[model samples]
Target: MIIDESLPGKEECVGSLKNILDALYVLNGKWKLALILCLVQSSKRFNEIQNEITGISSKILAKELKDLELNDFIKRNVYPTTPVSIIYEATEYALTLKNVIGELSAWGEQHREKVKQSMRKQS
Candidate 1:
């Protein structure tokens, strides 16, 4: 990479970079995407979500759910019933991430195949 300090709107580029970092900071976690994927299908109870995502602890799921709610990615609903029922559902704001999630899923599948091919060559 050659040095090019005379570029236009360098400050704007910096701001855009900051925006990207901020978004990543909110979504940065092993579980957030998985949890979002689960909720995309339909609203689910806490235990249903916990059961759907393997290897996620109840404590971590609870924390991630709270984080998602805070970020407006999901809505938590409480229904009055014989036993208080709490459900988690994706917010319309979260649908803004649909393209990003789709692209990531595509890239992940490609990466998995690439890694498998490399492993086969090693063998």
Candidate 2:
């Protein structure tokens, strides 16, 4: 089959698609980004993170924390103490997502406003 020389090559398209897939594989799901955003703001204990994010169960939070730690996005520090305090903090690597998170936050706000306007118009 002949190919269009003006268009992007198959290899280029595949590479881009692979990159997107890799990103989604790491960052997909409702709670991962939110959890990262929370830790980026401040290191917190498990209960504190759950309280800040709201509605995330203990089980899910534990899993997400482990996932982020494995991905090198967060550092889980365990202090040697009677209660064994553990604080979760965003790592420098996780800071790489700051711009992405900011843009997503802006888009979310704009989308919410747009939907509200559409609903009001319909009413």
How many pairs of residues in model 1 come into backbone collision? Answer: 0
Model 1 quality (TM-score): 0.81
Q: What TM-score would every model get versus the actual structure?
A: 0.81, 0.82
Candidate that would win on lDDT: 2
Worst 10 residues of 1 by lDDT: 1-10
Give the Cα lDDT of each candidate: 0.92, 0.93
Model 2 alpha-carbon drift over 4 Å, by segment: 1-9, 113-123
Please write out the lDDT profile of model 2 over residues 1-123, one tens digit for every residue.
Answer: 657657778999999999989988999888999999999999999999988988899999999999999999999999999989999999999999999899999998979988798989999
Question: For candidate 2, what is the lDDT?
Answer: 0.93
Model 2 Cα RMSD, 1 decimal: 5.7
**Backbone clashes per model, in order?**
0, 0
